[model samples]
Target: MHELGIVFSAIDTLEEVGREGSLSSISSVTLELGEVSGVVDSYLLDCWRWAADRSDLLRGSELLIKAAPAVSVCDACGRTYPTVEHGRVCPYCQSADTELLTGRQIEILEVVAT
Candidate 1:
């Protein structure tokens, strides 16, 4: 699945970073995942364990993910609302000009290394 692919990508990046930083070993990898990023955290983690085991650089690495809350800004009345509702129209002014403020990102934040 795509989760496996994503995990591999993260592991590859972590390995490269570890080498660039002169790290002896990677202990953990922290990721920031948006609620609306369309990724399942648990699934990604499960895939990570499998894929990481295949790599010496990431064999013992821990994957830590932080879920980011969903938020949206309305263009009509300059109001913001929770994007968890998943509505195209703004709840405040009922306008369709709402833009997403956050919760659509998948990023690697930090790496814990020895």
Candidate 2:
């Protein structure tokens, strides 16, 4: 799955960050995952457990996931609503003219070094 590749990318980034900061080991990493990001949290966690142990900087590290809700703004109603609940259509005015404001992102927020 693409989740493995995603985990690899995060590991690479964390490794670089660890080296830059002169960290010997990382205890945990906080990741912000969007509700509609399409990347499964369970899959990512499983991949992290597998991959992190291979890296010298990330062995036994915890992956903390913070869920971010998908939000969309409706042009017709000038209001924002949960994208997953209402989708492209605005619940307020039933308008199809809507824009996604947030969500669909996988971001690393912080890392704890030990």
- List TM-score per model, in order: 0.91, 0.96
Off by over 4 Å in 1: none
The TM-score obtained by model 2 is 0.96
Query: Clash number for every model?
Result: 0, 0
Model 1 TM-score, all chains together = 0.91
- Residue range 62-108, candidate 2, lDDT tens digits: 99999999999999989999999999999999999999999988999
Q: Which ten residues in a row have the lowest lDDT in candidate 1?
A: 85-94
For TM-score, the strongest prediction is 2
Question: Under the 3 Å rule for N, CA and C atoms, how many clashes does model 1 have?
Answer: 0
Model 1 agreement with the true structure over 3-105: per-residue lDDT tens digits: 8878888888877887888777777888999888889888999998898888887787899999889899998999888899956689877899988999998
Q: Which of the numbered candidates is closest to the native, going by highest lDDT?
A: 2
lDDT of 1 at 21: 85
